[model samples]
Target: MDKKIKVGIVSYRNTRPLIYGLQHTALSNDIELIEDIPARLADKLKTGEIDLGLVPVAVIPQLGEYHIIGDYCIGTEGEVASVCLFSEVPLNEITRVYLDYQSRSSVALLQWLMRESWGIFPEIIQAEDESYREEIKGTTAGLVIGDRALEQRLISTYIYDLGAEWRAITGLPFVFAAWVSTKSLPASFVQRFNEANAAGIPRIDEIVAANPFPVYDLRKYYTLNLSYQLDERKRKGLELFLSYLKKDNEQPVEA
Candidate 1:
């Protein structure tokens, strides 16, 4: 029997297709999915707890010798309603901003947008607590990502989608997560993974139908808002994101 490649993936709504489709398909025999947060997955990937991961793009710079095998990614062309920044005051006037711990990419993107585009230097606050609404009451702004952000739509007065902000600033699509392997797996295995991912994209409607969220307009969200393919524009965004991490001032922990 072949050795199973342990794959750690976050239990987010975005990862649902990859998680379910892979498990139900032939790839299930060769790969094992370990549910974890993005940050924890980065650590697991570094420590060899998992062979491959669907990790945040920000964590890629830290991984010393990882190979991005697949051409698919969790990306967006316009407003990603899930990853948002809610501000009580105007963006330029904000003094302090709270960040979501679940995301590293959104955090870095926010910093880049705020510094380069907005010309603002608000103090960034990394809050452990999940209540962004409560945090925003005291702070000027709050950065929230994933399903929690989607649920708090009523409370948010001024919502700024990071993906939309990125497109507006760079005129390119943004990739949040990708399939990164620490070592070069066999060509057959890589092909299998790619095939599974490609197969999942077409069945996104079926996946979204299973979701508990009230008719999230999956067609609009998947077809119009998000881009599953890793094209040249997303590659440019990934390169730009890596550059931001490598800056002398930005001391990101090397993997």
Candidate 2:
């Protein structure tokens, strides 16, 4: 009997298709799914608790020897309503920005946008709650991603989509989460995973129909907010994101 490949994924609405597709397909018998938040998923990936994962692009830097296994990803081409910077004040005039603990990729992307494009230095605060608008007010902006970002649309005055911002800045689509593995799995296993993922993309509508988030239209969310292929644009975005993370890490720490 072959050992089942353990795969960890963040419990986000965007992952519905991948999870559902995997479970319904023949690949279900070959692999096991372990669901958790992005941060916890990253820890599991690093600790070898899981063999493969849908991990944030920013966390890739922390994983020592992981290799991207498949071409599918969680990404966007235009205004992704789910990853935004909500502020009472204009972004340029804001003095403080709160970070979402759920996403390292969004945090790093936001930092790059602030420093490189906005050219504003704001006090950065890390917040745990998805309802950051309640905890923060006045001249302060909150970074929210995943399901929380969609929820913020009703309450926020300004919604700056980070994925759209990244496209505008770099002329490439952004990939937030990717299918990654510690090393190359057996060629048969790789092919099986690919087939399962490819099979999932077309059934996105079915998966979304069964989703629990009644607030947003599941069909539109899958069609607009998520990109399943890791094409050239997304690959470039991944490279650029990794470069930014390396540069940020090399910077001298403030005394």
User: 146-197 in candidate 1: lDDT tens per residue?
Assistant: 7777765667677889999988888888988888888989998888888887
Clashes in model 1: which pairs?
Answer: none
RMSD list, candidates in order: 2.9, 1.6
> Runs in model 2 with CA error above 4 Å?
129-133
Per-candidate TM equals 0.92, 0.94
Best by TM-score: 2
Q: How do the residues 82-164 of candidate 2 rate in per-residue lDDT, one tens digit apiece?
A: 88998877888799899988877888889899999888899999886655668656888888888878888777787789988
